[model samples]
Target: MKISRIVLASVLMVPGVVLAGENARDHFRDEARAATGELASELMQALQAAMQEGGPPEAIAVCRDRAPAIKTRLSLERGWRVSRVGTRVRNPLLGMPDAWERRGLAEFQARHADGEAYADMEKVEQVVEDGQRFNRYLRPIPLQGQCLACHGDRDQMSADIRGILDDRYPHDQAHGYQAGELRGAFTIKAPVD
Candidate 1:
């Protein structure tokens, strides 16, 4: 009778456990989106200011130097691992998404190719690694008019900007992009209890 009761209790708790997991996933997704938006806004503003003050070269500096600093600070403050990664990378330091991020980016690309709005492209998953569960979220980053000054057509780019990019990133693969194209993605990971 005791064994039967324990079995019944476990069966009854399954639904609640599943529901809790779903709720946790949703909560983490929302949190990731909010944090990503804030970080993107701050970075964009800083890049805009840098561009206005100098030019695309200065903006590159903002991306190369300031962006990592912002990611680090935000990660510490928000208790999440935050980063930007791309299929083609400009900075080697942050180049190449992990396996999970690669899958998310592929999905985003497929959705975009299927005519889905770039703004609507996102992926959130609960993954287990080393017996610990994590909530991983990714949102597409579409190229903008400002980004074209650096990441656009090679021939159209100013000589100074090209030179700077080549010098700073010897193996840069992040170019030849157009506005409205998927530039990369913001990826966030947070541990889940």
Candidate 2:
């Protein structure tokens, strides 16, 4: 039966993954990338849908509301994370994860935003667990004329829009970012062990 074949295939794959020859870190990293891609794609769709349906306010609200769900699912499904660094807000796992803690996001912000240097694109990998690896993919979040309505200077941003950003993320560092300056990263990670 198809079910049996699928189960057999799944069982067969587990050993190879746990096998010593194959690097667990690389396996986890690859898995994490795939997972992150799927999650990010879904979230992007949700954001776009909110924009079309609820407008900008809805778009922002949807993202704010869904972040926790995303984090929880990532932890449960992959035993990993979907998180942001450089956030003044506290994350319980910020320093407690058995194999995670990378400043890739913080580094990007520090160099690009504070240090006044920006890269059009960047990808860096770090070992979070002995065999697991995490990658941070970054690109600039530029400001377009259209975006000025929500994210530009105070004079340009309407009070409602500013309030939205303020309400959801009181310690937001996402502001003051431009189209070509690195906003942050799309981090993909998995345990090496």
Candidate 3:
């Protein structure tokens, strides 16, 4: 969900401070939303195609190989850091949340616990890291019905799917998710101008 300019302006406003480039920050947030939406839609299309052609095992390969490629392509095209982070990661190299992301995930979880719909959850902020400032955005990725083939309960998963996951991710922890649960988040960080 895109944050409204009125809400952003209200949040950034201070009693005696002059804020600058409010629209620039809003543009950055919109770009992040567009990139994240593209990645999610593309991955879903690919996953659905793979599932139809070769079932759950092929879908796993698509996520393992193609997902990272998609993220890399988006990062190059947008010149921003774009990736997914999971609460329980299947591939730690790609899906592990960093410290800042962990904090964002915690915030998401807390909001969800307080009855906020996951579909409407998002966080946007600016922070300085190592003398560089960035606009960071996070949105939760809710697990859908189709995701159950690989991400659902392991005990009920097919043997082929289990075998592939075991071979590829010896230390996987991304299963046991139900529909509508928080699978992970799409995170984007663009340098502030």
Which has the better lDDT: candidate 2, or candidate 3? 3
Candidate 3 structure quality by residue, lDDT tens digits, 1-193: 2668777777777632533467677778888889999999999999999999999888988999999999999999989999999989999888999889999999998999999999888889999999999999999998999998888999989999999999989989999999988899999988876
Best by lDDT: 3
Give the Cα-based TM-score of candidate 2 against the true structure.
Answer: 0.58
Q: What is the lDDT of candidate 3?
A: 0.90
lDDT of 2 by residue, 1-193 (tens): 9999999999999998778445744555566556656666676788778878977788766556775577568768866655433222223333122222235545555666555654443343554444545543332233344444454455566677778777755555445544454333445443433
Each prediction's TM-score versus the true structure: 0.89, 0.58, 0.88
Clashes of each: 0, 13, 0
In candidate 2, how many Å is residue 182 off?
Answer: 1.2
Which one wins by lDDT: 1 or 2?
1
Ranking by TM-score: 1, 3, 2
Tens-place lDDT digits, model 1, residues 1-193: 9999999999999999999878877888888998899889999999999999988888888998899998999899988899899867887678678889888888888888898998987898878998998888899999998898889998999999998988878888999998988889998988877
Which prediction has more favorable lDDT, 1 or 3? 3
The TM-score that candidate 3 achieves is 0.88
Stretches of candidate 1 exceeding 4 Å from the true structure: 1-15
Clashes of 2: 13
Candidate 1 — worst ten consecutive residues by lDDT sum?
87-96
